[model samples]
Target chain A: AQSVTQPDIHITVSEGASLELRCNYSYGATPYLFWYVQSPGQGLQLLLKYFSGDTLVQGIKGFEAEFKRSQSSFNLRKPSVHWSDAAEYFCAVGPSGGTYKYIFGTGTRLKVLA
Target chain B: DAMVIQNPRYQVTQFGKPVTLSCSQTLNHNVMYWYQQKSSQAPKLLFHYYDKDFNNEADTPDNFQSRRPNTSFCFLDIRSPGLGDAAMYLCATSRDQGGYTFGSGTRLTVV
Candidate 1:
């Protein structure tokens, strides 16, 4: 079965500092990868996705993620984080052939310090 | 904008009472999913409707039921509320191989 792992449970970063959240997955094929963000008391919002061509994908709110096939990692990065960017981050993997089901990782709680 | 919308941002029900949470979509996606998210946990798939074909997860209890009257609407029904069932119920929609659009979710409290 497919699964995802986010090694960090909590990360605190100063505002305007660079940030990276690590994610790794287990899948047989070239998996569909995605990053999502969830604020308190709110639903998830799509951050970015890696489908086929580009190894690096850009997403909403100045976020980007790089898909590294060899390492089975798709880590999220932001050059300058904002205070409002504090939230929970989730990494998910889905099958490529058209199944919409996704296996999500344990979330990483991000705390942006001023 | 095309989006998924869930009703009653928050709900409170007594023990053993029946409660229903509603979800509607304007995206016209064929797949609608229900997920249960407890505090500090990832969302767990409960069931989904693929254009009226219901698919339930093996571990999903019989106390939970769902209804999809049409492509635009889906409902999650809890037959008997329990303390353990108190969690955020999230509704989402997606096309095959496409990213999901999620609603704000309904927070349920079993009193």
Candidate 2:
């Protein structure tokens, strides 16, 4: 079974500080990794995805993620956090092939302090 | 911009009453999916339509059903409402092996 895990349930970061959200996935083969952000009462918005090629992938809102094959991790990062960056972040994994179903992590809620 | 659209941003329904949530996509994707997201939790897959074929998750309840009448529209129908069923229902669309485009979602409230 494919699964994604986000260890942090909540995180607090001051505005303009760097941010990192940890994510780990379990799958038999190379997985397609994705990061998504959701605001309160809103649908999820895709931040970035890792299909192949370079390990580091850039996404919207100045977010980026690096896929580490050895540790089975895909951590999301932002160089400078803003107030609007406060949201729930989810890591998801889909099979390299076959079904399109994506397995998502429980999510990590980030709070930004100005 | 082409995107997935879900109607009824919020819905209130009485217990045991039926409710339907609608989704439409302008991307003309081959797959349309429905997910149920509880408060502060990951979205759980309910079902999806690969074109006109419907696929249901193993753990999905029979009371929850879906219909994709065309390539651009899909509907999620709950036969009876329960307090536990209150959730943010999301609709998404995608081409084969492509990333998904999610709609704003419908927040279902059971009273």
Give the C-alpha miss distance for residue A16 in model 2, angstroms: 0.7
Estimate, for each residue in A3-109, the C-alpha lDDT of model 2 and write its tens digit.
Answer: 88999999999999999999999999889888989999999999999999999999999999999999999999999999999999999899523788888899999
TM-score per candidate, in order? 0.98, 0.98
Residue B88 displacement in candidate 2 (angstroms)? 0.4
Q: Write the per-residue lDDT of candidate 1 for residues A1-114, one digit (tens) a residue.
A: 688999999999999999999999999998999999999999999999999998999999999999999999999999999999999999989852255689888899999999
Docking class of 2: high
lDDT of 2 at A99: 81
lDDT tens per residue, model 1, B1-111: 989999999999999999999999999999999999999899999998888899888899999999999999999999999999999999999986687889999999999
TM-score of chain A of each: 0.95, 0.96
lDDT of each: 0.93, 0.93
Backbone clashes for every candidate come to: 0, 0
Inter-residue clash pairs, candidate 2: none
